[model samples]
Target chain A: MDDKVSIGMDSRRITTTQRETTRPFSLKRQPRLGESIIQGFLLFCGVLSMFTTIGIVVVLGSESIAFFRQVSIVEFVTNTVWSPQIDEFGILPLLLSTLLTSTIAMFIALPTGLAAAIYLSEYASSRARSILKPILEVLAGVPTVVYGYFALKFMTPVLKAVFGEANVNIYNMASAGLVMGIMIIPMVSSMSEDALSAVPRALREGAYGLGATRLETAIKVVLPAGISGIIAAFVVAISRAVGETMIVAVAAGAKPTFTFNPFEAAETMTGHIARISGGDLSYASIDYNSIFAIGLTLFLMTLGLNMVSRRLVRRFREVYE
Target chain B: MTTLNDEIKSGLPQGEAARRNVASRRRTGAIWRTIFLSATIIGLIALSLLIYNVVNEVFGYVATEYAVDPATLSDKPIDELNKDELVAVLQDNMRANAFRTLERDKPMADRSESEVYDLVIERVLKPQTLETWTLRDSWFNKAAIDAQVASEFPEAKLEFRSWLTAGFLTTPMSSDPLRAGVRTALLGSLWMIAITILFAFPIGVGAAIYLEEYATDNRFNRIIQTNINNLAGVPSIIYGMLGLVIFVRTLEPLTSGRIFGADSGNGRTIVAASLTMMLLILPIMIINGQEAIRAVPLSLRQASYGLGATKWQTIWHHVLPNALPGIFTGTILAVSRAIGETAPLIVVGASTFIVTDPDGPFAKFTALPIQIYNWTSRPQPEFAHIAASAIVVLLVMLLSLNAIAVLLRNRFSKRG
Candidate 1:
């Protein structure tokens, strides 16, 4: 009915335009005042996101300048001690802790996430996919704070029991990192599955036509084709692990020590910021300013990784279609 | 084929050896397939363990030792006592000065029956939990728990307690874990999310409209697109830092309600947090909204245009109605994400000890996640129990929101 009405209106408009050829034709082309205003409003709304980016940069940049003015760049980078009470402000310990946890998280997430993605994309039937996908999403939807609770209450105890009570601290980086990995598994798997599913079926069939097994086709043909997206997923997951706060803050202990041991307790950059800022700090205090410095560092690190991930997806994506 | 001849010259077997090689390869494939299947199972198991852990902590057995037993305080049960009787019991047991002070704050005569009864129990009965056991422990190790509680606190009564009781949802925050509740935090979360939606929905949808309908392919638009993508991936904690500087400090006059002549102290208001959340989730909403808008077929717009409708009219009358369900699904998902967010709100200064429900956007507040975070960080075991209950509340809220989004998507997809 709507289509018929539109056809009728189309012919009526054409007849009217043919009858009144003297009227200006360009008037309809120009946007009316109300149209322009609405468009301008929408454009402003789009620009608002740009403003957010600018705000983050300006806030982080300005506060970080204040922090660097008081503490030399060399000392901040080179010094291992992070005792703000004693006027020592090295970032190495926090940076190392961040790296340590992210590395541990990657160790757990990468293979498991990849395997799950391959299984879902290559092996799972549609009925199985429908059931399993929502389960993974529920895993994804469980809040990080709840994960933090599990890390503190459950994972830490299990780790202690497995590794011996003497080896694992109550608030170790391993428990936090392992739980962070668990928290991000769905992100990794879903993204990698998208990448794997994008690999054309013909490619998989070609591998199978050569008498290749399902695992071989998935591993050799599809995995190589979707490598860029899988790498993007890994990078994005790494950035997420590095920036995760509550799990580390709740379970990974607040002590910012220079250590490589996952069983020991130490603070990542995010954990430090969250733990310190959660406490009462007088405005403009050095302690308060230091969190911004850390935030700047974290922002730059994650931004660089995300940019790389985006570039990988755009630059290396195969035009299978 | 040449490699096969080379292998044959190198003393490789022909038929049986080739068959064995194929069998081994197939076995390896099967083994790896099992590994992959188990990987998926591991994720599901992790989810189950997380739920089990939270539920385990939410209900259990507690040994309570009251300073004054409720049985001794009244002829009838303590709950059945009238307001005046409860108030009289409070006066009899309490010091004169303390009772007078309570009456001075709010008259006992003016208080409701439940309020008076609660005060009577809080002050007079003072049921203190001596020992708490988890649900799993109470189930499997009941005998052991009973023995320990009986020996350790002979005066204490052991009873199964569900921390997530109806009363738990209605009460306010208390220093004592037994008396604590998530009412204040839940209100604050609702207020923040409400304001966040009010601001973010329009801005996000408008941005999506501009990107999809109005803006042509250009450097400026592409930069905006890339900027939004990067902002979406920016560490949420950095957004918290941005909120700390921009909303909580620079915009103190506005966010603190000083401009409105309301005496909300400082800029750590729900408005500030909500705006910060709006910024954090805006990219998500815009991206989702863009997808929803893009999904509206061009033929629909063309049909409206063919009917002598303006571009805006086509969008408003035809495209928007068609896209509304999708937009709602995105908005619901974004709001659910905002509900669970803790890091940004913490930096925006969510009060860990707030008791009063937030009455306006400018009021200081705590969210459910923040409450859980604060409780879990405490050294006391009971706080963990309450934190788990709060987790249950947060999960239920998020799951319901997600279910709505899913249902909306399913219904719309079916219709379309």
Candidate 2:
């Protein structure tokens, strides 16, 4: 029924185009004034998103400029301490912690997410896929704040038990990073699954025709073919990890320390912003301005990754089609 | 084909070697399959563990020590006391000056029985929780906890407490975790979300309509499309910064209701937060709305046009009705996302503690997630228990919203 309607619509469209060409002297239908006004209003609404982007850039840029005037770029980049109380503003510790947590998150999410994607796309029956997909979505739908609670109340204690109680701080990057990874798994699995499923069925058939096992075909041909999309998913997940605030804020301690140890409590850029802002700060103070600078840095990092991910996703689509 | 098969068979490793190779490969396959399945199971386990961790803290054994025992205050029981009796209990126990102050604040004669009862409990009984234990510990180590509590606080009374009680839902915020409830925060969240939907839905759908139905392949439209996509990926905190600079400061007169002479303190009003949230979720709404609008088949639009309907008429009459369910699903999902968002609202200056319920958009507000974040950060163990209870509330709210969206989508898909 639907196909027939579409076919009839297509024919009508063809006839209309033909009529338009043949009757060039006929009056062109003009939209009513009210219709044009509504269209204009809709267009404004469409362009409103551009204004939002401009607003974000303007806000971040202006505040970051003010922040940079007081603190030298070299000191901000290279100095180890981030004590806003003492007028010291170095971004290294926060940046390092952000990188550390994101790295840890990536380490957990990438392999597990890819394996889950491969399993769902290549192995799971339709009924299993239907059941499993929504469960994964439920994982994603859980609030970040809940994950923060889990990180602080649950993950930290478990981490403490495994690595002696003395070694793990009550609030550490490891617990936050691990929970953030769990939060990001659905993103990775879903995106990678889309990419894997988009790989043409003929390739799988050809591999099977050559006596290749399902596992062999999936690992060799399908994985390579969907590699770009999987990479894009990884990039997006990493960006999400880098930008995640609550879990890190709740579990990772507010102390800005340059430490490689995931067990040690250190603040990420996002966490620092959340923690400092949550406290009462006098408006336009150096401490307040410093959060904007950190936010600008985070925004740029995530934006860059998102752009790269978009390009990779686009490239993947191009290659397959 | 037969000759090629024969050639391939001749070239292959014969019988036992080939069997061993195939068997080894099969074993590896089975092992890898298990590994992959376990990865999925790990995700499921993590989710369950998260739920368990929250549930474990929400219900437990609590030991309380009061300044004056309720049994000593009432002939029967404190709970069974009438309003006048409760008021008398409060007037007798509290100082004369304090009693006058309470009367001055609100006359006890005018207060309800429960209100008077609560007042007596607050001013007279002053129940202070001495210690708390998790549900698991309460179940398995009951004797241990009992002995510890008995040794530690001989005068304290121990009882099982479900932190998420009706009182927990109705009572306002308090510094004392025992007295604190999510009433203010829940109202604030609902108010902000209601306003957010009002602003975001139409604008989102309008933007989507323009993009899907009316957009010509032009540079401006392309820019708008790309901007919306990028805006969705922009860290939510940046939007908070935008709200801080724009709605909170630059547009303070408008957001704070000063222009309207309402005397809201600042732009940290519910309206400000809702607008900020509107911007944050606008991209998501527009994207989802676009998908929903796009899903309204071309045949429907063409049929309407064939009947001499204008674009707007066609969209209103046919496309919108067909797409309503999809749009609802998208909006609910977006609203849930907005509801869960903590970072942006925090940056936009949600009050960490607010007692009075938000009565209007201009009022200062706290949200459930912000409350949870604040509670979890506190040093007190009792705060963690309350935070877990709040988490349960937030999760249930989000889950129900999601379930509704899922049901809508399922029904729509079935029909489509």
Candidate 3:
């Protein structure tokens, strides 16, 4: 199928060319049977993926609509207390917790990840880079649940011991956010490293010839060139942090109270969904449907972030080739 | 671009002052680079420290805890020995150790034999030391202890056993370290991964191949592409809710419809969870697969057609083989991701209490992450040891799978 399409497309290109080929188009048309099979395979993938998205939207939308009918839109959106046990199943606290963790996570991750990217792209030798890159990526591969356990069992006790009992809780957002930050560092490093490497070498050499130091060249030239990718990395990392659940569920306590304090326990949308579903909530109940409503909000936030990053990446792509 | 300083600096480069300035600048640049280099090294060391912490905690249990000396057992046939003989052998060792300790402390002669015997039992049988506390090995049996006292140092030879052993794999979790094992959880994880792969692969790849090879680049294709990228970024927990609605409630009648009059689908079966994960990663697979297909060189298709092959023939014979490497890379990565995912599985209902191995996709199941979460949530100290061991197993599994993917990717890249 691919061959037929390519051949048909290629023949069309050939016919339009000023110089004509000897082979007639009819000979190529014979391959259409085989081409259609390949085309069918391709079409199947596209349609299946399309159906999946539609399935998600339809399933989520219908349930969310059912939920919203019971819980007013204002109460669900604006209220600070997110006690689903109450009549008002507000999502504000979950959103706050998600934002607090992801924001703090990015605050720690962005600088370290970017610096690592710079060192790999500009300073490190090939031997060092080959050894280090995989080790860095290993962070991403470690299951988030492991990080969750480490945060709750290891990090929480250490935080309390060092900073005092009043400063930390067993399910504090700080430890979860800190460990979550560590998990996201590799995502930023790898993406930013690729972007920095993609920056044309000519730009670096030109800066060097003009008497700028390697550090200056990296900061002023390579960084500027890779800014779009850097932004994309941050955006993706934040989205990842927001979407993360097991870590927050295990480490961050299930108290969905709105608070700016990192030392206190909080809940995220993903965490709440896990907690609620794990409970014996009946399928037809408002709480069950409310999960769908919260899911829609989470989905929309991440989708928005992904779309923005995608646009930024396309706009910033250096046509070096 | 011209300045007095530029001319002076350019012209003075041949002199000592210029040489010193250049050397100083070079020194500063090297120092700055050295700092950056050290930071990278430091970052890696931190990662190593984290791995070391987990490994140390796990190996520490395997090392100091519950490891009985094999020499103590002396290859005794316990089945031939009666219960009375077993009791006699145990009592003899109990008396010998107590008497020996009493002889060493002559001032304690006023103490009763019962008191001395109780002390002996506490010291030998109790998990007094970390080593003695974990001894569940075959060597820790009464015969083993009797033989060790006779052959080895009469006083110094003692049973050191592991609290965790092969039995840990078969047993359910208990408050006591001796009873805790991951058998049920392991079976659950195996079933979960098996079902997840079965569901996710065909649909994900099918979606990928369609978009890459068949679908035209019209408004519809653009919409599909946009939707997929957006779907890829959506929180995984959302899929769980979708599954709950679609599989648990809507499709309950079909799921509960048993052919042999058995309860087939309880809404939390492996099928529901697997289907949910499949939906979650479908976008990822489609996007990755599409990229893979797009990456296949245009010349391969042209060359295949130059031989007078049909369109399907060209794709099946030439284009697909060329694209397989990239597709494999995408599939492997997607699989790795699905393996580690915890949130969606949790929301979709992975039972923590599943004891038997799943017979098929319809069976209830759990995963490593879910098990780890269950273990870590509890307050028991011994559970931490098992949790660490479980983590080691999980990491090793993920690492090996990722290594295979890397190997496959490298091979494909070379071929391309």
Interface RMSD of each: 0.6, 0.9, 2.3
- Write candidate 2's Cα lDDT for B1-416 as tens digits: 99999998898978999999889889998999988888877778988898899999999999999988778887888878787777788878889999998889888778889888878878888899899999999999999998898898999999999999999999999999898999999999999999999999999999999999999999988989988988888877788889988999899999999988886878889999999999999999999999999988999999999988999999889998999898999999999999999999988899998899888889999999999999999888999999999999998999999999989998989988
The candidate scoring highest on DockQ is 1
By lDDT, rank the candidates, best first.
1, 2, 3
lDDT of each residue in A240-266, candidate 2, tens digit only: 899998899899998999999999999
Choose the strongest candidate by lDDT: 1
TM-score of chain B of each: 0.92, 0.95, 0.70
RMSD for all candidates, in order, please: 4.0, 5.6, 11.1
Query: Stretches of candidate 2 above 4 Å error?
Result: A1-26, A316-321, B1-7, B70-83, B97-107, B110-115
Q: What is the lDDT, from 0 to 100, of the residue B94 in candidate 2?
A: 89
Pairs of colliding residues, candidate 1:
none
In candidate 1, residue A63 scores what lDDT?
A: 89
Off by over 4 Å in 1: A1-28, B1-14, B69-85, B97-117
Q: How accurate is candidate 3 locally (lDDT)?
A: 0.74
Query: In order, what DockQ does each candidate have?
Result: 0.79, 0.65, 0.47
Question: Which digits, one per residue and each the tens of the lDDT, describe model 3 over residues B1-416?
Answer: 56987887676666788778778878888887777676566557657756755654453322122123322522455334444443443455556776566557652355555544434343334322222212223324546545544564443435433333566667764444544567766676677667667777776766776666666789988888787887787778777777777776676654443533546657677777777777777777778877877888888888887887766677677877877777777777777787778887787788865666666666667677788888878776656666766777678778888898899999878876
Worst 10 residues of 1 chain B by lDDT: B7-16
Give model 1's share of reference contacts.
0.80
